[model samples]
Target chain A: MNRDRRQLVLMLMPYLVGLVVLVLLPAAATMAMAFTETDLIATSRFLGAANFVELTTDPAVQAAVGNSLSYLMFSVPLRLVIAVGLALLLHRRARGSGTARAAVLLPGAVPELAYGLMWLWLLNPIQGPVNQFLLLGGEGGRTALGTLPPQWLTDPEDARAGIVLMSLFTIGETFVIVLTARLALPPEAYELAELEGARAGQVLRRVTLPLLAPVLAVLVLRDTLMSLQASFVPTLVVTNGGPPPYATTYLSLVLYQDAFEYLRYGYAAAVAALMLGLTAVAVLIQWRLLRRWASHGIVGAGAQRPGN
Target chain B: MSWHDPGRRRRAYGAVAVTALFGSPLLLLLAGSLREPGQPPVVAPPLIPEDPGFAAYHQAITHGDLVRAAANSMIVAAVGVPLSLLVASLAGFALTQLPRRLASAVIGLSVLAMMVPATALLLPRFVLFRTLHLTDTLVPLIAPALIATSPLYPLIYYLAFRAIPADSYDLCRLADLTPMQTWRRMALPQVQPVTAGLAALTFALTWSNLLDPLVYLYDRATFTLPLALRALAAMDPHNQPVFLAGAVLTTLPTLLVIGVAQRRFMHSYGPEGAP
Candidate 1:
């Protein structure tokens, strides 16, 4: 028994060491630095709550927080909807479904910088195909109205939309999860719905959607947390956080800029702390919402109960 | 569900449409990169370049330092992916052996670690590494894999191990195999597909990682492909063909990996009929 214990400890030692050096200690330092003032080059001085107080009034920080929230508000739901829609579309073994799935997954496999760069080119106002297709009708002829293409990266709202659109393409992982969930539904339930003369839409609305709610809830929470962090790369690479006015600057980018660009490590740490709190709050809210839904028999509860 | 079966022909057409719509950007990237460099910009870029050549590809490789940055990315992925897989799998196996409460606590902490936005760790990690004089080196970039900092990989490994039947371990014990030996001989063989999938995912993650390398490495020689691509984008915004070429080059390895491991990737998520 002792030998087994020793072997187990030996096996776990690398991870334990890593946990201490990489996660626990750094996280502690980040928390401590949140309450101090330092430029990274200079000696640090403790300033209780000073960074947080300033963050409340800082215009850039405010804009960043707002932008990040807006990004999440738009991107998360759009991504989930697209993911679920595609999963439903490709759930069956239709001809060429394998190829279709691969196409959907391809963008996600691309590096972030490359993906952003591709979007940057595709959304170019003048010569991009997206605009070109919009200008020309489906028959490859110009539209009668001569509509002008929107400047995607230059305009703030359009830039935000572009980021959201870029996000929509990377739904491969979520698509897989939802697809698996859809496939896991007991076939007998569908057969029973059919035997009762239920229509396809009715079956979906009653059975499929309810069965999927639990997975959807989890996916939403994961996407929300990811949106808070993942937006940084595309915004940085594609929009560089703006055509001025810092339109696309997200909280992660703000934290990054504060630490690396401006060298204000303390202020960045405070921003990081706030970002962490926001993530925790988001998770908690989702947990509560899921519990309510589950109790109301809108999700997993329905999965346990038989057909009405 | 039967009532909504759009006819087979229509479903096929719809699938084609979806693929085309989703694939156009990458297709455009490929087409744009082949365009002759000096050609005047068109009002709407053509699906195929009028005069395609290897000039942009040549310029991207020769002028952009793409080869060097790609080497750096390869070095990172090559070292990081295997190290992460080994560490995560071992940690996961050990967790499975721990008492129930301790295992749950460790798993909970791991989940919490996953929830923490990676951006939050940048400054403190930088401070720690700088104090250790490890900044500007690849050590900071690779060190996190030692603990599987993302937590997801270890969780995946744990789930994979959990799927093994208890009788298999009992049989191994009856054969006089120690736990370590049993893991090496029994569990490792059963989880080959998971290992392959995890290795591919880890490779893709490390190769495409931008923020960590951007924050840690200062030297141009040590820049990863993404950082190099960023520099290329900034240096000449009008040189679209060159930029596209660099993007294509950077994405090729990941695309290939995904295409090759596509089957194993699907299986790693869940069992054949289970989510």
Candidate 2:
């Protein structure tokens, strides 16, 4: 038993060392530095709560937080809807299903920088295909095509929309997860529903959806957490956080700029803390919501007694 | 299952529509890369370039120094992916053998660790690396992989290892195999699919990573492919074709990996069942 314990610790040593040096140490340092003022070159001085206080009133930081929240609000639901929708559509084995599934997964495999760049080109106002297609009505109508295409990267509104659209294609991971969950659903419930002469929509509402609710809830929480950080990349690559006014600047961008660009490590740490707190709150709220959902017996009752 | 069902037909159409809408950007990218340079740029470049050639690709590679940056990315992946897998898997396996209470605590800590976003760690990690004099080198970029900085991979490995029956360990004891030997002979073989999945996932992630490389490496020589692509984008913003070519080059290897391991990748996400 002792030998086994020793061996286990030996095996775990590398990760334990890593956990301390890499994750815990940095996290501790970040928490500590959140209360002090330092620029790495200068002598550090404690500034308790000043950073957080400034964050409350700072216009740029406020704009960034707002932008991030808007992104989370819009992107998470859109991504989940698209993911679940695609998973349902592709879960069955039908003609062309395999090819369609591969196409959906392709974007997720592309590098983020590459993916952002591709969107940058596609959304370009003057010479992009998206605008061109919008312009050419192709016998349906020529009326709306005459108007100028939206300046996706330049205009602030379109830029945010562009980011959201870019996000939709990378639903490969969520799609696979939801697909697995959907596929794992018992077929007996569906057959029973069919025997009762239930329509497809009724079956979906009464049986399929309730069964997949847990997975969908988890996906929502996961996507929400991811949206907070993942928005940083596209904003950085595509918009550089802006066409002035810092329109696309997100909280992650703010933290990055504060630390790396402005050399205000202390302020950045505080911002980082806030971002972490926000994520924790979001996750906790989702957990509570899931628990409440469970308590209501929406999922468990349906799962245990399907199609009653 | 029901070919004659109208709902199935609608779903099939919906699937095709989603694919077309989502897949058009990539098709456009491919077409744009093949467009002839110096053609008077139009309002919406043609889907099929009138005079297609390899000129844009040639220009991107030569001017962007893509070869060097790609080499740097290769170095990072070659070292980082395996190290991450080994460390995470070892930690995962160890968690199974430790007392249940300690294992849960460790698992909880790792889960909490995972919750801390990478952005939150960026500034402090930068400071830590600066203090260690490891900034501007590839070391900072590669070092995170050693610990499997994100707990997701380790958790995956833990769940995979946990699915193995406890009787395997008893059998190892009956055979007088050391725990290490037991892991090698029994557990490792059983978890090959998980290992492959994790390794591929790690490789693709490391290969595509831009933020870490951007924060850590400053010099052109140390730049990864993503950074190199960013540099190329900045240098020639007007030349969309060249930019697309560079983007294509950056995307190819990852696409190839996914295409080859596509089945295994999907299987990895399937329901975990006891063996």
Estimated TM-score for each candidate? 0.94, 0.93
For B136-247, candidate 2 gives per-residue lDDT tens digits of 7889878878677467787778888888888987898899887788778898889887787677678789899999988888889999999999999999788888989999
DockQ category of candidate 1: medium
Per-residue C-alpha lDDT of model 1 across residues B158-201, encoded as one tens digit per residue? 88898889999889878977778977999989988888777777
User: Mind giving the per-residue lDDT tens digits that candidate 1 earns over A246-290?
Assistant: 888899988999898999889999998999889989899889988
List ranges where model 1 is wrong by over 4 Å.
A138-147, A302-308, B1-7, B38-40, B267-275
- Could you give the CAPRI-style class of model 2? medium
Residue B180 displacement in candidate 1 (angstroms): 1.5
What would you estimate as the lDDT of candidate 1?
0.83
Residues A105-169 of candidate 2 have per-residue lDDT tens digits of: 88888899999889888887777777777777643323264555678888988888888888988
Give the C-alpha interface root-mean-square deviation per candidate. Answer: 2.4, 3.5
In angstroms, the error of model 2 at A201 is: 1.6
